[model samples]
Target: MLRFILNNDDIGTALPPGMLLLDFIRYHQHLPGTKIGCNEGDCGACTVLIGELQNWAMHYRSFTSCLTPLGNVRGKHVVTIEGINLPGSLTAVQYAMQECAATQCGFCTPGFVMSLTGFCLSHQAPTLTNAIAAIDGNICRCTGYKSIERAAARVAEILQPRNGTTPAQYAAGAQILPDYFVQIPARLRTLHSTLESADDVKAQPIGGGTDLYVQQHDALGKKALRFLYDQPALKGIRQEGNKCILGGATTVSDLLASPLLQAYFPYLNNYLKKVSSTQIRNMATIAGNFINASPIGDFSIFFLALDATLVLSDGRKERELPLRHLFKGYKQLNKSGDEYITRIWFNLPSQHTLFNFEKVSKRTHLDIASVNTAISITMQYDIINDIRISAGGVGPVPQLLKETARFMTGKLLTESLIREASFLLQTEVTPISDARGTEDYKRLLLAQLFKAHFITLFPQLETAILIR
Candidate 1:
């Protein structure tokens, strides 16, 4: 049985664990505020707030309901637009949208409203940048983004003093949501006690469902599913000695929120911004990205540059493999179906090490990369002591350029070296002409990206570079 609080009601059912939250809400629960557009996690029409207790406080984050499985929300509070709507008055988000005339056709309005409301309910500071980022997942054909931006700013003003107060408390007092939200934390605690775990045979493990649902939503119902997004054993980011350890089910959002990772890699947040939108990142797990084995997976390429390693397990036995070696070929991995990644860890960059990630796609944000690359280097007195470079979209799999890396090691930082390395990388990649770009284009792009790594880190070398 699956159990969770739907808005103000406690509900338990024996529905298939693989059933999507979007289907259950619209068809079974008759909640229509969450529109279905781009059934994949894109477009954000099905965005909704998922409230779960953390550290004895209710924390809220917006999720794309279309890709979220029911089992993933077990013993949690699921809030839709209807859940936040006041009986006789508009919530702060709704009021701001209306005041700014942010809606035209209104198809994407509910999602925008819920995302912004979640922003108000979040523990993040109420800065204008954070406020605008709240709706980065949504797409409106009306091109009324200016008005929507204004609405977001107004909502941030309303939430200026949101600190020292739980989002539920502030929302309840301000009538942004019904007072019942204040009691949800206790209710969830009670619900967690009554929940019983069920065992199912022939279950296909689904984490986040961001990618699985996009690829196989229609065929998932008949397949018994085990949702791993909330598994405690496979959640969290920690540091053991000099290595950063990430659990298999840890989402990109989890990495972004991790203090350990932030302290180790101060530019992590900026690097991840090129990966995906907030709605997708909130659901896409690190292990899933690596296991997906896509040549263009941003995280796969990112971690490969750091020389990350994965701990593989089948519940009883475990083994470690270098992340770069996990992929056997295009869309193929070295592990079997039953074997899953338990954790991923990499050494923290030393004081002499410099790391950078570069990505280019049709769209700069929230789109698949045409070409992406990352570099980690250690230098001593402007001489490269060691270097590793990884790239995607130019090979059969996310590849670590061992040849190029070896050539650059113990080499001086000069324009000639960078140009020679660029040419060296040309032979390492095997890009094909496709929708992203031609093979020749990708070849050129990788060269430019390689040069970018040096120019970005050492602008003084820009004048000396003649790679182009």
Candidate 2:
């Protein structure tokens, strides 16, 4: 049985857990406000706010309904545009849209409203940048986005007086959302206490369902899947001694919010901004990215350069494997069918280490990468003491450029040395022609990205000299 609160209504249905929330909302519940656009997560036409009780307060995040499965919403509050409507007046978010004339054709309006409402109910500061970022996933084909930007600015101004109150309390008190939100925590506590646990060892393992729903949308509804997104054991980022540990189900948004990661990599937010949109990052999990095995997966290439390790479990036994060995071939993994990744850990970077990530894609944001690479190097007075380089979309699998790293180690940092190392990297992988780019283009792109790592890390090195 699937039980949850959907737009101020308690829902308990016998629908399959793998059934999509978009389908259930539009077809089953007869709510047409949440329009169906791109069935994939790319289009934000089906965006909704998912509120979960964390530490006795509701924390709401935007998620694309088309990519979200029914099982993922168990014991949580799911809010649609209808749920936030006032009796006879528009909420602050809706009024801002109307006042700014941000709607046209009215198809993508609900999604934009939901995303902006989510921003109002979030702890993020009420700034124009944050407001714009909140609606990055939504696309408007009619309005030139200047009006949407104006609306987002108005929403930020409306939220400027939030002070220090929790986002939910402030949103409710200010009429940005309904007053019923203030009562969700208590309702969720009762619901969670009575909920049954579904842990089937033989069932298919599903995390977040961000990618699986896209590839096997029709087949998943017929399969028995054990949802692992909310498992307590697989939902944290912690540090122990010299190693940083992360649960397999940790989402990219979790990393963005993590102070520990930010302290280690100050530019993490900038790098992640290029990874995907806010809605996709909020739902895409670390283990799911690794298991999806896309040749150009951003997280896969990022973690690969760190030489991360994974702990695999099969319910009865556990084992450890280096991430470098996890990829056997294109879309193939070096694990058993019953085995699932439980935890991922990597060594903490020291003061003497410099790390960088580079990617070339069709679009700067919210698009797949044509060539991506990351490098972690430990320097000993301008000489490379140790190094690890990983590249994607240049081979059959996400590759750890062992030969390139070996060639660079113990070498002095100079234009000629790096140039020689880049040449060696070209021979270490086999790239193929695809929609992203041609074979020669990827090779040239990888070489430039390889050079970019050094250029970014050592700006003192003349750019013209290296490129020439």
Candidate 3:
């Protein structure tokens, strides 16, 4: 038996494995406001706002119905487009969609509206840049994005009066009963594990099923996996002392939107915003990207470059390890089936230090990286005091160029040395060819990227002062 809140009503849905939320809403509940587009989660047509209560406080986020399994919504809230706005009275978002004339074919309206709705609840009168981040996960091929931004902006301009200030809360006392498919032993639930600390949590640990579903649905790889999601543990990003701890389930969308994150680690958002389509970023987890361990995972490139570390834990114990030490060989990680990534720790650079991240991708959206570079340098009076350089989409793991950094620090910031250093990076990496780019291209780019970093460093070197 699974329980959740839907549209301020307590309800239960006995979901079976492989039952998609988009299908369940359209078929089981007979609600049609949530549209379905690509079943693979590429299009945001099936977008919905899912709510979770953490420490008795409620927060909301958007999800693609196409990729989210119905089972994942258990003990949560499901806010469909129909649930938020009434038949006659339009929401600020819906009314704005009408006022902006953002719809044409009608296939993508519900998703845009739902995404705008989530954005409206979470944001105030948003700027175009913020609007781009919020609606990036939602694509409308017919209307382009101009009208959609207008509709989204209108949410802040709504003139109607409201009934007090309480946003609709998904009720907690939901009715639940037994189902035939799968059930935990009553003893397991009775034990030490809380509902939030659900054991045997495999597929649900994943945020957006883009990767998981692609792995399962493609028939070329790991198939038929049920889920991965976290209600509390895998959700927020905050700093603890020297390191910034990002939840394993933190989304690219979250990283790009966070003011605190940008103030400290601006390069991550600046580079990752160029990664996947806004829809994919909204759902893909930073942890999942690392866990997937592709040599080319964009975030890994910057993370490894930034000298970030990752935390791994089984239900029993937890350990923190250097992110560069993660790969054993090609495509293998320190994580085992019994263990999972719990958090990522990136050392926040001081105000005076300079950190940079860049990636060469096949396309601006939904393309794999050919080569990625991260560089951090502390300089004083035209001499390099300290430096760290890491590369991604280049080797088996995001490789730390320790020897290269060692050879360069305390050296004169000269043009000749920068050129020689670029050549040294080419020797450090081994490349593999795939659909995105060739091995030769990666090697060539790695060398060029090194040159770019040095150019940025040398000019600042003479003018900049080391923190005394």
Each candidate: what lDDT?
0.89, 0.92, 0.68
**Which lDDT tens digits does candidate 1 get at residues 200-309?**
42476778878888888878855787767888888888888899889999999888899987877788888898888988888899999998999999999999999999
**Which parts of model 3 have CA positions greater than 4 angstroms off?**
54-57, 159-198, 201-208, 217-228, 231-238, 253-260, 266-268, 277-279, 454-468
Per-residue lDDT, model 1, residue 66, is 92
Flag clash pairs in model 2.
none
lDDT of 2 at 272: 93
TM-score-sorted candidate list, best first: 2, 1, 3
List residue ranges in candidate 2 displaced over 4 A. 464-467
lDDT for 325 in candidate 3 is 84
CA displacement after TM-score superposition, residue 348 of candidate 1 (Å) = 0.8
Error of 2 at 157 (Å): 1.0
**Candidate 1 Cα misplacement greater than 4 A, ranges:** 199-202, 466-468
Candidate closer to the true structure by lDDT (higher is better), 1 or 2: 2
Model 2, residue 113: what's the lDDT? 97
